[model samples]
Target chain A: MSQFLDISGLNARIDADGQEKEILRGVDLVIPPGEVHAIMGPNGSGKSTLSYVLAGREDYEVTSGSVSFQGKDLLEMEPEERAAAGLFLAFQSPVELPGVNNANFLRTAVNAVRRARGQEELDAVNFLKTVRAAAKELGMSPDMLKRNVNVGFSGGEKKRNEVLQMTLLQPSFAILDETDSGLDVDALRIVAEGVKRLRSPQFSALVITHHQRLLEYIVPDRIHVMAKGRIIHSGGPELAQQIDREGYTKFLAEAA
Target chain B: MSAPLAVTLEPFRKQLEGVSGQPQKTALEALHHTGLPDRRVEDWKYTSLRFLAGSVFHKPGKNYDSAKARAALAALGLAEGAVAELPRLVFVNGHFVADLSVTKGLFACSFYTADKAEPGSLVRSDREPLAALNTVLAENGVVISVPEGIDAGQVLLVSLGQADSDAVSYHPRHSVHVAKGGKLSLLSVQAGEGHYLHNPVTEVFVAAEAELRHVTLQAESDAAANLSTLYAQIEERGNYDSFVVGIGAALSRHEVHACLAESFAQVHINGVQRLAQTQHGDITSVITHAAPDCISRQTVRNVLDDRARGVFQGKVLVEQIAQKTDGYQMNQALLLSGQAEIDAKPQLEIYADDVKCSHGATVGALDDDQLFYMRSRGVPEGEARQILIDAFLEEVLELIGDETAREVCKTVIARRFPVSEEGA
Candidate 1:
């Protein structure tokens, strides 16, 4: 049928100081419903830039591109509008909103997204129950809900919070950027298991990372190697093993 | 000193000549000497009464209809909810309306200066020309004193500056005393209608080991001017907790002078002043650590909209005998519009060697990153801005020690901001 997320000839650049530096150059990607993809790249590669572009963060000029989410123009939406359209971006470093209670922030967001989808909003009690269960499953303490969002949280706790939000929002499409970098082995497993639970006929994810360890827990169906602002190679899960064994030296040389 | 000032003072001078207390005569004499503080005075540096200088504001000889007074209280929405049950002392246009107040069995007003008695100790008249005017022309006031070893219930003081007359001024003097081992909670609200000038003075005396909680909310009209002064002196082991929330008024200032006179005395002054559309608001406080082993904390927040201006001038004075004193003061502002302005001045004058005193001030717009973070989480842009603005001011509100008054402050603040989800 139709592609779930279609990114075709996506070229993006950020204005730094006085010059426009290209970050994502003619990148093309497509995933049907229910498929998970991993983007493995070295530092200075355009992996994180791609995730930001999809999220519609300001200051990035999409020189030439098209990102179609569920057959709609995703690039034309506001960040919140994008969120309302079942598109979620789990930030590499989840933002800390000081003075905003974790629970209140999530509830406001959940209600916003829910209303946009023509769904009735959850009451406080029901929202609490859902959040509590999800937080318990993610091994996050209930007090995390009482404190300010992501403020004073440990590195692992912030990552777990991202997964917690992902579980709560129940997005049809998610982009996890380096979500496992600060997490420990146990925390990584919990986060990966949380993501794995969302794998269904309608759910899809693009996990962006540098290491292959996270890929072991929630194994992706496809792994893409990116270098020098472009995804230069694509292969099956076996390709991830090859990169883990040899590193991105092969892709870096070829892309140059 | 000048012919114009004397002419403007002639009407008030004639009104004061009708009263006959020694304190009134002395204060009136001082009023003639200083003649309504102007821009030149250091204490009134940022605030200028030059506009008021031209207007001949007659003393409030206006009558108070209990119906109108009650309606004003009801409009505050305070009487509709939790504050309804509070036994309040209602003053309308500088006159106390006995019919609108509940003053019989719950708590007694020790001194009703309405009947031309009880001077309320005009302590700051020498330093403050406004206090001089208050002592000379104050028509009515409430002085509630709790005896030693008593736990008196809280009392509400509601002052409405609404009157039918043109450009009237009222000076209502209030004095509260908590004797040794006594405790008291006082919630004071000052609101007005139309163009008027409200100059109310308050003097609080906290005896050794006593406690007092004072919450003042000021919401005057855009055509009005308000200059309220509070002078508090605390004894050894006494505790003073005070919070002020100001909104509205074309020009308003709340001047506080707190003296921790004895050892182990504590004082807290936490306040918020909000203004919109060319309105000007000020929170000026001077705290003194006169004795050793005392502590004082002052935190104030200002949220200005449109072309509004906010001024925060706070000073902490520590005497040589005030060793081991601890003092902290912070004033922060959030300007929602580009045209909004804030002037902050924090000063410390300390003679003690073993004291820890610090002060800080910050002026900024609503943080862009915080706003974007909330918006990205699916909160609408308007709602996101409202949330961040509330959070910025909530930092000061949360510092209030009393729960009920803090909630009232929060409700008032939320209702004033249109985009707030809580009040919306």
Candidate 2:
């Protein structure tokens, strides 16, 4: 009966040298639990800014609007606080932390979220066991756990690392920020399957992507078309097929 | 004695005369006029000892109680009876405690004692003014020698300072010699509590075909000031490696001067300096390739938080005759707070046209995107920042080679990060 995540009239801007450029203008979105929604947009369409704003990056200023996650005021929380509240963002260009080993970093992250939820921390053995299984399902090698997080990894490996984190954290709501952008065909299939395995009645996803090719594998329940910082169209999965066929030329003409 | 070398040497000589015999005291007095290193000094510009100009010096104490020394040793976490197995040497307030030193094989007492017993046999050379200061003022120090074709276990040298008086200063000296075909590992630790100053100098000589691994751990008190200088000479076909880890003291400076005197010698120097609050730490090194086909690599990492400051100055010189030399140097610093400062300068002076020499320096905070990436993975902000910091310093720490030693350094580094025990 309640919305899992509700964003109403969200506005974001970037200030470069005394000038303010609006990135998001009066954007509204809603997604209930147990549903997957995709937002498809061209380059520089403010899709990444929306994800960053929702994740509370300090650089993006939210001029006005409200985002409620699980009935909690999302904007009022720090990025870490949002994460502890079961909010996840699968970055498009996941960062490479050279010195921190993958296993140790994952364990620390998982336990941090758990402690915030008033749960006991997992011991090292138990944590390693869980990570090993999840890493295997994501097609990650054992050596990946020993290496620094994403350091020297290929583009596809970084995407898999994000999926690995999602599987480990098991967050209630996840925002996949173009996770399929640089992945190969096999990696895309594996990542889509990883998301599919995580699907549940209590879990929801806001997948930001540009291509409908990924939708063929993940199969979003609904699709939204975003242009110039606002969603102009919302429909069933058929909308994705239509965009893939006709392209954004007709939509650009209509908006004009 | 022909108008003592410098005015600063007068008080130091008078102090040494009261603690030891004639020859030793005279040798120390001979080092007098070596001008005090100031900001104007080329190598000492970034680190100035001008603050020491006004301070009065204290003489070495004669009535050091063994029981008190033993208690201090235990507090440092040395296992009981561990000293007996170690080729151990102890210094109290810059003066050597002969009763506590154990020497084996070619290892003897101080250089003066060693030379007196066998003239022209000791490896002795004069270069730095501070080395002369340590010799003249040092009442107690060590001379360690490893015979040819022998592998000596790790030798532990502990320098302890007791500041029973107000603002006392001590200069300790050491001499180490490794013969041809010999292997040696030395752990030199400087620790003390009180308002005191420690100025220590060590000279090491590695013979042809010898290998030496040296580790220096400086954990002096926050109120103490420390100046340590290490000078090593590597002969033909010798290998020398030094790892210096600094974690304490209000003001500390470590200088390592390594010279490859013969062809085909190799040197590796790695250091990590972690400072917080009002602490100041410096790692300055100069590697000279006087012979052909020499190789050298240096990596220095510094982590500064609060108002702490760190300085790294590295210089690699390839002489004209030293063709086919390979040298690489890098210095990186992580500033956790806005007030923290890091000054790093990597220098290269190469005259050999056929040599490969490169140096780089970087000073920065944690990556913003990396921080958000970790935070989005459910890691708290503090923990996320710490992970990034750890990753930044991991490259340097991984060069330690020893797993246990690396782990110990890792623990110390982790504690430096702002992580609660509950979070750990």
Which candidate number maximizes TM-score? Answer: 1
User: For residues B157-212, could you state the per-residue lDDT of candidate 1 as single tens digits?
Assistant: 88888756457888888889899989988888888787788889899999999999
Per-residue accuracy of model 2 over B1-424 as CA lDDT, tens digit each: 4454454443344454443544444444445444566677787777766545555667757657677677766655543444345666777787667786665532433443423422112213244566555655654457778889788766777888777656677876677888998888776777777777788777788999999888777878777889888888999999888888898788899988889999999898898888889888999888999999998989888988889999998888889999999898988888888999988878889898999888888889877888778777778777676666666677788787654445545654554345643331
Backbone clash numbers for all candidates listed: 0, 6
Scored by DockQ, the top model is 2
lDDT tens digits by residue: candidate 2, A1-256: 1578999899999987889999999889999988999999888888999999988888889999888888888999988889889889999888888778889989999998999989999999999999999999989999999998899999999899999999988888889999998988999999999999989998899899989888998888889888898887788999998998898878777776
Error of 1 at B365 (Å): 2.9
For candidate 1, what is the TM-score? 0.93
Residue lDDT tens for model 1, A4-120: 999998999999999999999899898878999999999988998898889878878999978899999989998888888877888898888778899998998899889888999
Residue B51 miss distance in model 1 (angstroms): 5.0
Which parts of model 1 have CA positions greater than 4 angstroms off? A15-20, B1-22, B50-56, B61-68, B111-122, B420-424
